[model samples]
Target: MADQRQHVQGTLSELGTPLARCTFVIVDLETTGSRPGEARITEIGAVKVCGGEILGEFSTLVDPGVAIPPSITLLTGITQAMVAEAPRIEAVLPGFLEFAALDRGTVLVAHNAPFDTGFLRAACGEHGYDWPAPTVVDTVTLARRLVTRDEVSNHKLGTLAGFFGVGAQPSHRALDDARATVGVLHGLFERLGSFGVDTIEEVRGLRATPTSAQRGKRHLADDVPESPGVYVFTDAKGDALYIGKSANMRKRVRSYFTAAETRGRIREMIPLVEGVTAIACGTGVEAEVRELRLIAERKPPYNRHSRNPERSVWLRLTREAFPRLSIVRAVRDDGAPVVGPFRSSREAELAREALHHALPLRQCTQRLSPKKTVPACVLAEIGKCGAPCEGHESPEDYARHGEAAREAMTGDPHRVVEALTERIAALSAELRYEEAALYRDRLAAFLRAAARSQRLSALAAIGHMVAARREETGWEICVVRHGRLAASGLMPLDSDPHAYVRALVATAETVPPGTGPTPRAHASEMECVLHWLDAPGVRLVELDHPWTCPSSGAERYRDLTDWDRASPSTTRR
Candidate 1:
């Protein structure tokens, strides 16, 4: 570690305030260099203030142990040779902190503080003196806030001193600057009547603007409001800090903000925060779905789930109109076409590879985004994409087929069954039993998918995104979305058999309308699934258990694990 670091720990805890506090030292340094990494402090000066009164003043030239820059020679009368025999920070910093009595509520007051504080902290951390230093207030941020244009054009210490007719005498001398700073702070504090900065305890207790910002980001977080949707906090980086889902998003989110008023850590976070974002959904169930999808995309930092958004992509229907098929991609880029409007070749490749499954469209060779000059894949000859190659199919036809596939993957799975049903009816009417049987088997598989769709629908009803995993103890269920956690329930081998049956039913229910299975549809399946997942005796468990019930291929349990890391819908804004 460097000498600067010695001051970090030693002075970190030593930062404090004035008033009912002990003496604070406003200090300044004239340096031979711009950065602590290379620059050496040429001069150090301090003015001690206690109970709003100057207690003492001190200034000194430091033997930089290095040659002073010519600029330094012109600016302050200190020369290259003047400080060659002077004291170093090792000798001066400790005395400064001691006089400041930073260990006793004495804060450091400086201008453009981070630069100086950063240097000071670096020094403390290095010396092993570990400053345990008191708080350092930047007169810069304070003066801009307190001095306002009506009183002054600039807030530089020299400017403030000039306003009070003190002029910059002794000019760049460290002691003079420090003295001038203390005087300026005193004048501004008296004029403002109050610092207007209440205690963390006082601000935490109120849900109003905890920290000021634009309208969108104000303190609407008192209680996550009463609404069905997801809530988010986005920092200045446009990165999500947290995400949550609730029928009462207002109240739930508000609960986190208001409830933590007493937590010092939370108080610090609230003030640094920019604002919150929300997505309103159709139902609390819809909110959960949307939340899961969002969590999958926007990995807000404050969210435990936020970290996972980038690693996983959800299977989404690309075309959505007709040739129903699935594609794995981040949600935000959905509208950008693989077939048009100019897209990169890499994205097209990824879209195909991720969406590639045991399905027929897996063999496409067509370029994605902005229809390409080359068209179709080898599978097209066999009717996979209607042979868009060699102009056998029109661009409209290609789009239609792709649309159909996308639609099949998205819309109701019933559409697949309906199309298959028509094929089966035509085959049977032609008395082609063998072909009809093939259609029948395909229909069975289609019917299986339809049943699974019902299970996904039911997951939403319970206001959760469920991911069941096996553990040594039993099955663990992680219900989450975005970065916010909704619930984690476990199903142990020792649990009630009835609840297990219900879970299986969600995965095994008969098909709904329009599929090749049964023509009947029931609205209650989702409700029943909700009742089973949430029944009181449920416990949280890991899903890796050996004896857990098997899931059909359609059950997206793998997605739970992957999406546990996968970003929800990717963001555009």
Candidate 2:
């Protein structure tokens, strides 16, 4: 029985800090006014509780540095004489902050958190003391979730305290009110337990009420282990309806039944879901990669991302006598420079147009023969093309333009930007503002795709790499091969990471090389890896290759144009 109880506690702790193990400093304050700037806190009181027992208490009267208001004094019975010899807020704040110990997993609780925390933060700011942002819990919010209007007239501290029959009662005093709030917090926890909310995260995310469908489907998540992983919602035939990933598998699955699951499509998908399949992963990044792979393979109806990675288009130089820019779905190893795995063909076309504005490459799609001269289209007359179709530009001459375009696509794009900028400036000077704006949009579209392609290529060139990031529990280590997440694992706090890294690397998935920048891996997966690598505190554990990108990649030219703002729909990755 003792072993079983320990097992249950251990399981609950894995989700997050279990509510029973959390230390809460219930606080209450009396003030001269309601709002922060308009008010001054007069009295501060707190009771630190862990596992329903009081560890210590902190109470102090603060001098507001101003006269107490008559209405406030009358309500709280704190007369001006009562605080004449009290310590100023500067002295009192340090003691209060020390007692809270917010940095050491001590959660701050208040009846109305905003009011108390606001005044405290305001006081800290005014005195030039650093405000340690604490994880705060509001008893009023918790009570409203558990005790409806039918059970209590209102969720005020006094009403909740009286309903719970706590030892202390609110008497418009800080210490008494704080003591009353602790009891109300404990009472709410009792109610939350019935709903299977055992962790601090669950307590914080508790909803007022759950949908009937959500309540009925709660059992679907019962078998999910408490770990980071991917989850699949399946219909009766065991086909996937939706797929998702989260740091905690059990917590995320259970949340689908709560009111917090508010997405319309997901709400609709829930009624059809007959079961959930959980795949435990070693880290959050691995779960994300797994979710993307599963979604692409299964094509889950409810998943929008990575569902159609094959549909991505690219802008590449065609293999012909007079090679022209073409939008293709698949990349080839023909050595022609390719620009994208664009989200859609429309974006690829936009990027193509931008490149055309820089180089007078032939706009025609038909095969052109250097030996035979064919009549050129009107684009040749407009000088938009070098008219290779009409044999006006020889294959040798067209090759020069193609090589320049190739340089812009693969290496530096300064010439492309300079050419476009000259045209835009010339148009704007001629009062052709509309034409200039169009050129600007095209430039942004091209740069956005180029920058994303370069970033993806840099990471995808590496054969094998291992990286780790510091987490509360330990290090989140990942094994990446050609920018694909091969495997992930955790090294417990205070343990050597070398052995764990070796084990994870040995068990990682074997990935084969593919053609182009993002070899063997989906562009989305590479982009995810780039984001993780760039995040703060990530340490490179091992690397087989020196990962690098062209210094003149389009990313360097972002400051030269308002690309991000003008081309908001520019597809990345």
Candidate 3:
């Protein structure tokens, strides 16, 4: 048998202080049974060691206050007589807790930690002693990862101890089993060293052995800075494989090589990643904005959403004699107001239905002239529209209602919201629950669209603005123009604020004039900028135009949109 003292001392010296300096207390318990709440611990054995040197040893027998089962006595060779003169569990638990106090980087090691820890924890709870939740390391978990099934018969303590030629053998005695575990633990440490695992953090975080491809690309993260930023994983041909944001670029990027990355898509992408690039940002918000812009510009193969601006749909008020809501794929400046940049045509149509239900807006597909004479449609007959097609309603009067509908879409949504609220209440009162739900969803969609429109409109009206917030090392500054991020940088606390501001403005990115009707890319950027500006404690440094949303905006109809109350529909009636 190997000298236990020499094996531990040798391992500690070679591994250095991070692993060497750790104090490991290997523990084992012989109990009446497996259930912690009901099973009583008959014997407790522990060996506390540091750097392979045994620092202390503890062993005790405890009276369970109950008769030991014949089966358990046969398995453990412990009976009622063995613990008859011994102190009760309550008396023995205090000393054990003190011995395992989790200060000074102490770690508790067991073959299967939960089994032993559970009994100890239950004893603490029952005896009214606080459980300190010491950091636990299970050798069984380590064995599963380190030794393959082909190399070991099983993960049992005796199996591992026999495989490693441990000095002490577990024979149903607590102290002998705990000593055997110490040997198994040292052997596992030696295996971990082959994979360059040295630190306690590495051991604790070790999930699976890295693949050869992952191991080869480990150097890609060597120079990645540990800061908030956006990271792009590129393929062998330099095509962006994936783009992600993280507070710690190095840590996040490194995680892709481990078993923690269970997403099969990401796993497939990882092996193809030949390069890793990081764009460092001053603040997390800046990193988020950059991620959005980069994804929009690149439309990277792996990115699912926010990849294509052309895919966006909008709700446009047509520029005609009698304007009607139309769902279009693009935005145009035709002298008529637009509400969205909505996610889909379906969502935009829902908002349109809500507005049409509340106002007499023409729904005809044909363009009508003031002098034209045509038959009115069923919508006109049902009073859903003021028919300008047949000249039944005068163009001037129809235009007035069109203006009200436009106001509900853009600035004030209270009128439309109130009308929908009453309609929903009436439907629910008649027990037409599905119809009421349909109207409720329509109202919610309109309210959301209106709120987005109002915010985007207000942001677009601001020609340019400068916002700042104090940071630990400096000030975070951003310049926004027409709802897009123009420039963003960090100004050091020691630098002149005015001079830095001027420098930032001089080097700010030139935003191109609005190309499409929706300007979805700029709108997305604007939303990002607005979110940052709205964050608590942000200071408005400068503004070419006042940052304001319509006071009578969609927010006023917030309470009317609640669908949770049992009688929410009654409020409108």
Candidate 4:
């Protein structure tokens, strides 16, 4: 037991000053107004406490050198007459500063600290005194961390005082409130004991009030390392319940049981969590990709994304005698120009509508042979389509529309964007607002899909690549194979990066070339890779192909599409 206590103390010493060895000055102020520059202190009250024992007290009234408004007098019960004969802030400031002794490494305590400290700092500045800028702990923040709404109505000092049955009751005066806050602070300290928080640093770093279940399960975090990694929460049967990654594995795993983790699904999964598995990595991107891969493979109940990458739908121009646009769940090697990996079928349909609006593509969801004629649909009646199904339009003529649609998806979208924008303008001019809005949605969806497809294809076409970003600790290096993260490592600062890069490349996952824009990687995963590539200071160390996107791509239509969607008229319905 003695060894355990010594071990705990040694651990905490590295964290911060222990509460038992620290002195705290609990302060409260009655001000003429809220803003620091706009208001002056009417009264100041503080109690200095170390280990729950009051060491001293400081109280004073200050003449604001301005008339106290009736509203301020009503709220704090400090009238102009009360402070008219009191010492001015310049006179009262030094005595209070001396009594607080914050410059001697004492922690400052206050309820909603910014208000009181702001005024104090302003007064010191006005009086030509340097502000100490001591470590501040807000009791209001601590109360919210330890006490839940079930125990107290709010985090206000008065509410907490009543909840704790503190001897002093707050009455809008400075001294009474400061005394009441002392009891509230002690009560919060007792609650912190259950979470193993005894040091001032732990108190300052406390996140949220953990539920009893989460508190009981806190032991699960005992083995998690303090490093960048992926973590898995497993059930009694050893099946993964949730998967996540963080720069600090231990801290992130611990947060699952804290109030900082407020996701309803995660809270529900916590009780079932029987164990935690940690996979330490050399860099954040490596951890991220590992988490993505694990979640995709396990399809954990609490993990939402990358689990069903196969469910993504795409707009495909079918390869046939007369090709027609169709929404497909998977792409084929038939070399058809595809538009997406759209998250939902609805988005693919919207993109399809936008293309149909510009070109005379057949809306019929069937194989149309150039040799056999079929009945036309209503789209043909309205001239929205050229009725190629009836052979009224030759395949050569229909081919022009199909080629234009393909070009819009894979290359410059100017033709489709220009045609749709013109139609939107014409509709808005005629006050056919709803129809114009529908067209606007379709255009935006098309542009969004086109931009993503172009970006993904540009990267996916590359055979092999290596990139590095300068980080504080080292150079974050990643090896990419067809837009998938194959391997990643951090080259230690001041070390040889070429050798490390070679070693990482040699051990990377062997990736065979895959078909289509996203290849073997999920679109979302490729997007994450793209995000890392786009960050500042990222240098391409090696590449098999030129890393570039089409200069005439749909990216140019982004602003106009965004503006059309954000227009006030379209937002109403």
Candidate 5:
């Protein structure tokens, strides 16, 4: 034991160069699953190390109580039977937190920090421990930076141990992985001289705070309206990051960015986020209508459903040579009637799963292996899809069934679902188990969406629509006139949404394609005076909330910058 301690001291001293004054708590975990939130840790091991010395180490096995998956048991060599008898996380957490908070402060270090820290935080929350979220250093991240391409076959603790010429204890156990991570840290220190790892304070200083955004929202100078309109999120460089809609501009605009999904990305983004501007509408209904249009115009990355994902080809679902689902850029408006006009190709594919539940439809996306010899898709055998992929069903026979599906998804959804239930009983009587299952799942999602859907049939119809989600710098406008796309324009919008959208729509005939139009153009000034003469019913909406307005209220609009180019006397409404 004394010899092992000396050897460990010698190894850790080498890391002295890269890590200046910082102390680190080396940690490891055996988790029940890969995802952070749901998974429970079965074991935890950690050690406090500083100035080339091991101050202390703690290791404990936890009774997760939940039966471990077989694969996880094989990897960790800890069976459900072994953990079944161990102490709970609550009993083990106090000792763990004690070691973690040792010596004033220490950053946690782990081979795969996310795996360890995720489990640790989760356990702390479960046990009600005061684990003030700790800063972490990933040895895995460090090894990637330090290790040469040929030296390591993989970055797992076993592979990393082999590269550093450090032998690991029984692998997969939390204590062993922790030992391996410490070895990697020592190896990196010897290889790269004097690399500085920041203390928690220094690391946290890199984070961008939400104060600026809060201040921007609460700015006394902003012109806010109670109506509906669009809002623009922009970076310091004046690049549009996101575009959103709100009905109550005062309340809805403030609700955006409730919290950053990922702190790392948001921290990097915070200092760069400069301001947000809003457009106001008279009602929530109008806001929802315009929100879809604005999304098609802007194409913001933050807004996934709104942006057109590339490589996403819409399934036309044509009655073609394949007699199955056919891929295309848009849903076919060709002679063969389309079953769906889905928002996305992915959603269209997922819709297949739900379709079987909602409607009695013959479905396929395969064009390979001739019938009789060809085996059905796994989904077909498992009763998730109808086995039409094998050419067992003809388009003429399935046409009525397909029509029911189209109604459920794109048209009269109520009638579509009601029609499918009657058909499922008939298919079951015919012993078509595969056909029944497909309709079962599809109907479930359709009903769920329908139950949640407050949509009254497309009342104020706009023409063929193509929309893009807005980003930080400028807003986007996708114009579809009479069921055909006129064009798309990206334009900077005013914080006061009522004035902004009016300016945008009134001058829609002039802005250049691709990017947003210049703010405060002379043509816009001339058009606003003549705005009511054209389309007077432009609308605004707030997202995830029930507020809206028409573009009619005078108090609903305000321009932040007062440099107004007055409308000439010749301009008449």
Candidate 6:
């Protein structure tokens, strides 16, 4: 046992502040009930330890001043007779608090902290003693995050004690349970060390701690700059491992090497990272756009989203005698209007459903000649579709419904918005809340797509423009073309801002218009720029044309996206 204690102390010293140097108070309480205000603590047991050695121990039976219930007696084996001669809580608490005070950095450990802490706090409040809030570690929360369900049947104190081969078994007695908890606590610390959790900060934020391999690469972040930039982590083969943007490249890059990064995939990839490279930007907005472009171009293996526009799906209104909404992989300039660049086919399908339900447009996939007749699908009989396949609706009339759907997809979304709003209201009134939420989600998807389309359209229509926002030391200038950032730079504050703006415009990098039908890369870059322009206190210094969303369009539905409200109707304009 002496050798084991020395080994534990040695292992802790190699980590941050030697765990051996810190004081931990493992506490347990036998209580009458779960809550503190309503129930009272029958017994308090605590063991204080440092350097893997027990420094002190405290145990007491408290007179709760109430009759002990039969169920409580059965659970804890503490009867009124057991505490008949015991000191009252008011008399016992003061000594316990003194014993637990911090000579070194002190921490309170409990199986499930709230239960113990809550009762202790209540006891202090009732007795008119101020409760000192100390650093607390809940083994229950730690176990849940670190241990898999397969490792143990449960996170209960007894289960953990048995699993860790604790000498003292919890027998519904406070002291035994407190001792067992100390064993469990040590076992957890050992497990966390394997995952690169060493310091008290890492232990407190264990859930976000990176893997041991990632922590081993802390040296790689030494040279990173403290500036807005895009960073790429690379493998030994010189291939990109992961790409990210940050307002502070040094801080963000350093976080990957510490216990602060919680992402499982990033932690796995960090071991492969042999180096990191960064490109500084004038502003956070520029860094974001550069990150997106690099991720899209490099196709980094670890980048999950926005790496490939080809994989994105869109809802298209096909050009035919009777237009129908269909989910397609790529958008084409085939004179057929498209609603998205939606993140997934599922979202596009939802938007398609919302539009179909609102507008009496055809839902067929077949190409119908103006005179040819084809069998209609069940959607026609259900009154969801216009049945243009069966010639039940004339081309002119079907075209009007198709036009309305197209309008909603492009700019005007009032009809579709009202339809979904009414449906959500009806479903909520009927107590079909789940179905209402589904409709609400579908409505939000449509509105978001419509809003994006309108914003992109407005920006693209301007062709070319220059905008500037005032900064502390200079003017941040950006040259935009077809809604995308053509170039951006920082110009020192000059008496004549126009001269610096011209120089910035001349020096900025030129990116040609995208060749793809949707211009997704350009659209993404434009979205980044739009986000920057909309930032608070940003002022547009110059423009070739006015930049604005459609006056009475999908932009108005921005408020409806707040789905957390009890009723959308109450928040709707």
lDDT on C-alpha atoms for all candidate structures? 0.50, 0.82, 0.79, 0.84, 0.50, 0.78
Provide TM-scores for the models. 0.35, 0.76, 0.71, 0.75, 0.33, 0.65
Write the residue-wise lDDT of candidate 2 on 12-71 in tens digits.
124567888999999999999999978899999899999989999999888888999899
Worst 10 residues of 3 by lDDT: 7-16
Backbone clashes counted, model 2: 0
**What is candidate 1's local distance difference test score?**
0.50
lDDT of 1 by residue, 478-512 (tens): 44322123343446768884576356435532322
**What does the lDDT read for residue 216 in candidate 1?**
28
Candidate 4 residue 266 Cα shift, in angstroms, is: 2.3
Better of 3 and 4 by lDDT: 4
| lDDT value, residue 341 of candidate 4 | 75
Candidate with best TM-score: 2
Q: How many backbone clashes does every candidate have? A: 92, 0, 4, 0, 66, 0
Ranking by TM-score: 2, 4, 3, 6, 1, 5
- The sequence of per-residue lDDT tens digits that candidate 4 reaches over residues 427-531 is 888888778788887888888888888889888998899999999889999999999999998898988788888999999988888768888788878987898
Two-way TM-score contest, 1 vs 5, winner: 1
Clashing pairs in 4: none
What lDDT is obtained when candidate 2 is compared to the true structure? 0.82
In model 1, which range of ten residues has the least summed lDDT? 7-16
Q: Please provide, for model 5 over 355-410, each residue's C-alpha lDDT reduced to its tens digit, 9 standing for 90 to 100.
A: 55554444544453434435576766666545555666555555566665444433
